[model samples]
Structure formats: C-alpha cells, structure tokens
Target: MDILILAILIATGTYMLNAKEQRKRIALLGSHLANYQIEKLMEALTDGYLRALGESTDERRQQIWSLLSTTEAQLTEQFSRFAADFAKEPEATTRVSRLAMAIPFAEKILPSFTFDMRKALAIHARGIAHVVQNTSHLAPKDRAFMMTAELFLMQHTCHWFCKSKTIATARMLARHQTPHEQLVASVSADTRKAYLTLIKGG
Candidate 1:
C-alpha cells in the first residue's frame, strides 16, 4: 500500500510539471502565430493602400476600396474565431486582453481617403509591444533579443506601408522609429539570421 501511494504521487508530480511547461509553450506559440497572422493581414491591406494610390482612374479606386473593406471585415472575423478557439483555462481571461492588444486592427484596417497615418503607426507599435510584454512571462534565455527582433520585423512592415504610400509620409513616419530600431539593432547577428530564417518559412 505504501509503495503504491508513493508511485502515484510521483507520477502526479511529473505530469503536473509537464503540463505547466506545455501551457507556457502554448501561450508563447499562440502569441507568435497571432502576430504572424496580423502581419500578413496588414501586408494585404498595405498592398491595397498602395494600389489605391497608384491608380489613375476613379472606377479602379472604388473597386479596390470595396475589396479592401471586405478583406478588413473578414480578417477581423477570422482573428476573433482564432482567439476564441484558443481561449482555454488559466489563459482565457488573460488571453482576451493580450490578443486585443497584440492584434490591434479591429478598426484600423479599414482605410479611408484621409486616414491618420500617425495614429495608425502608434497603434501598430503598441500592438507589437503588448505581444512582447505578454509573452515575457515565459522568461526565454534572450527575451529582450527575441522581442527586439520581432519588433524590428513589425516596424519594417509598418515602414514599408507608409513608404509605399509616399515618400513624404514615409519621412514623417520615420521619426517614430527611435526606440524600436535601437533595440532591434542591439540583437546579435545569429539572432537576426534566425529571425530571417523563421520569417522566410525555413
């Protein structure tokens, strides 16, 4: 009876430890995958924005705008579904707020004739920061390095969006780069290479 009880306790302890570790990985991966999806969705919106600017005809602009508006709605619905599916115990409540901050495109994806570029960039930066902060609890060996790398990728995506719109607006948005670029530049070469590899789907 004593031996059986000891064995059961040992098994329970091991299982508990493994479950905790698995939860941590799941949270990290959920955040990472959500960020990736956000980036790709933004890329599509940016492409639409650039296409709208390049068109010389009013009819084409109307068509592009219609298509983009639909895309925006679809992206939001998809993100909401993704979050709901992953909102499990011990993470559900926290995940709700984290995903909101991390995604940050509930309304911003719908571009208009006179959209506020500065405000959009600010929201984008905040989204990236929130994701990094939320996942920091995982305590990776190089958390700062990894966060900065992710930030750099995000900033570049935002910069390209603005730059594609026009050089003048891009110049104006360039001032928003001080903090993100500084940390991004601090990452080691290997870390950067690794980021590139992961980003490229390698």
Candidate 2:
C-alpha cells in the first residue's frame, strides 16, 4: 500500500510539471504568432496605402480603398482570435489592446474624406512601439528583433506616404537601411529570414 501511494505521487508530480511546461510553450508560441499576424496586417495596410497613393485614376484609388477596408476587417478578426488565446496573460492582453486602438479610426474614415496619411501611419507606429515595449516578458529577444523590423517598416511607410509612390520610390524605401536592420542582422540566420518573410507577408 505504501509503495503504491509513493508511485502515484511521483506520477502526479511529473504530470503537473509537464503540464506547466506545456503552458509556457503555448504562451511563447502565441506571442510569436501574434507578432507575425501584426506584421502581416501592417504590411497589407502599407501596401494598400502605397497603391492608393500611386494610382492616378480615381477608380483605381477607390479599388485600393475597398481592398484596405476588407483587409482591416480580416485583421480585426485575426486580432480577436489572438485575444482569445492570450486572454489570461495580462501583458499579452495589454499589448493587444494597444494594437487594437490603432485600427478603428482609419477604417472609419470614408473614401470621400480627405485622409491624413501621416496620422494613419503614426497610429500604427505608436501602437507597434507600445506593443513591443509591453510584451518583453514573452521571448524578449525575439520580440526585440520583431520590434526592429516593425520600426523599419514604419519608417518606410511614412517615407512613401509623404513622397509620390512610384516604383523608384518603393524600391528606394525597400533599400533604405537603418540601425535596427544592422542590429537584427546578427540574429540567427533563420530568425532574420523569418522576420523578413513575415514583414513581407511571404
């Protein structure tokens, strides 16, 4: 009877430890996936904005506007899914809240309204910075690298938002180097490649 009790206790302890470890892994994975989703959303928005800016015809611009609206709705759905996953983590929840605040205003601006591109870009950049700052507990190094890539994207988005969007302008923004890029370049080759792929939505 004593031996059986000890065996059961040992098994219970092992199972509890494994469960705890599994939770940690899930949380970490959720954080990374959230970052990836944010990158995809931002990339889609930036591309839409640039396309809209580049088009001389009102019909093409309206098409891009419609595309941006659809992308915003899709991103909002993705964010809700993320919030469900990260609901228990306060840091994650806070980061999600900050990121969410950036979406609605831009979406509410009608196609006929004179939109302030600078203001729209600022909202996203600010939210990204807030999220990056608040989410350091979950895979800090990876999050830091993601922050760098996001800021890099933000800078170029603003650059093109101000300048006339041409192939030359787009290529120039893509080619522009920042200190963040230099810093993140030293991350593991796989990590760097994944960051680029995520930002580019590939």
Candidate 3:
C-alpha cells in the first residue's frame, strides 16, 4: 500500500514537470510565431498550389502559377527571418530531447539524446529558400510537390520542439496524412542531405 502511494506521487510529479517544460516551449515558439504569418502563408501557398495544378487550360494554369510566385517569395522571406531570429535564442532555451517521450531536464541529463533545435530550424530555412527560389528549372508541379514537403517537414520539427518526438510524428500523420519518411523523400537532394545529416533522431 505504501509503495503504491509513493508510485502515484512520483508519477504525478513527473507529469507536472513534463507539462511545465512543454508549456515553456509552446510559449517561446508562440511568441515568435505571433510576429509573422507563417502558418497563414503556408496555407495560402498550399491552396494556391492546388488551384494552379487543377486549372485545365494552359493559360489559366500559367497565370495561377505566376500569381502564387509572390506568395512563395513572401513565405520564404518570413520563414528565413523567423529562423534567424529563433536561432539567436540561448542554447538552454532551445535544447530539444530526441527521446520518444518528454521528460523535464532530459536534455541536460542526456545530452547525447538531445539536439539544438536552432540547427534544425536553420536547415529548414535554407531548404525552404532553396525550393521556393526554383532555380533548378523544375516543372511547376515538381516545385509545388517539393515545397509542400519542405513545409510539412518544417511543421513537423515545430511540433517536435513543443512535444515528444512520438507525439509530433503522430500529429503530423493525423493532420496531413503524411508520413515523415515520405516528406523527407520528397524534398530536393540538397535539402534531403542536409536535413538527414542534422536530424539523426527518430
């Protein structure tokens, strides 16, 4: 009976600690996110991509693609700025554990299992900018697909920063019906190489 009571106390304490850590991460990300319309821009660009792809006539399709270019540039600019700003945060505030579950102070306790999220965000910034610039002469459809993958992958990292890796992966699958592996596979070769090199955790 005593053991059971002690176990319950430990569990409650741990839960509270985890929640506190998560809240800090959520607040930090939210404060920066409030300064820009990254989410809104992503939605706009995604929808515009679909519309551009759906247009049947060549002229209309071309026009839609041209129209979305501005949005693409805007998203790239905002995200790069966000990443740059976020990277300036202190290491203590940006350390994210790679473990499957969130544990308060685990990043410090297990440095091998943790990584600096600033690096991940930097990789994402470069990937996004590279894709959006469309300098490789990729077809409109290909560019859209690659950009979608880049955005999804970036979104995944944000979720991971705010929660456990397992939770983040589950949420990505639930919301976008996209597996993390698929997102990685769809990005450009340069983006894929850099991302995979930095993201060694499950």
RMSD of each: 19.1, 19.4, 1.6
- lDDT, candidate 2, equals 0.45
lDDT per residue for candidate 2 within 13-131, as digits (tens), equals 76665456435534654454555475577567656666676788888877776666566555545544543443444332121101111222222332222233323333344435443
| Best candidate (score: lDDT) | 3
lDDT of 1 at 6: 100
Tens digit per residue, CA lDDT, model 3, 66-97:
99889989999999999999999999999888
Q: What is the lDDT, from 0 to 100, of the residue 123 in candidate 1?
A: 33
In candidate 1, list every pair of residues with a backbone clash.
none
State the number of backbone clashes in model 3: 0
Evaluated at residue 33, the lDDT of candidate 1 is 50
TM-score of 1: 0.32
Query: Which stretch of 10 consecutive residues in model 1 shows the poorest summed lDDT?
Result: 94-103
TM-score each candidate.
0.32, 0.32, 0.94
Off by over 4 Å in 3: none
Q: Could you tell me which residue pairs clash in candidate 2?
A: none
RMSD of model 3, in Å? 1.6
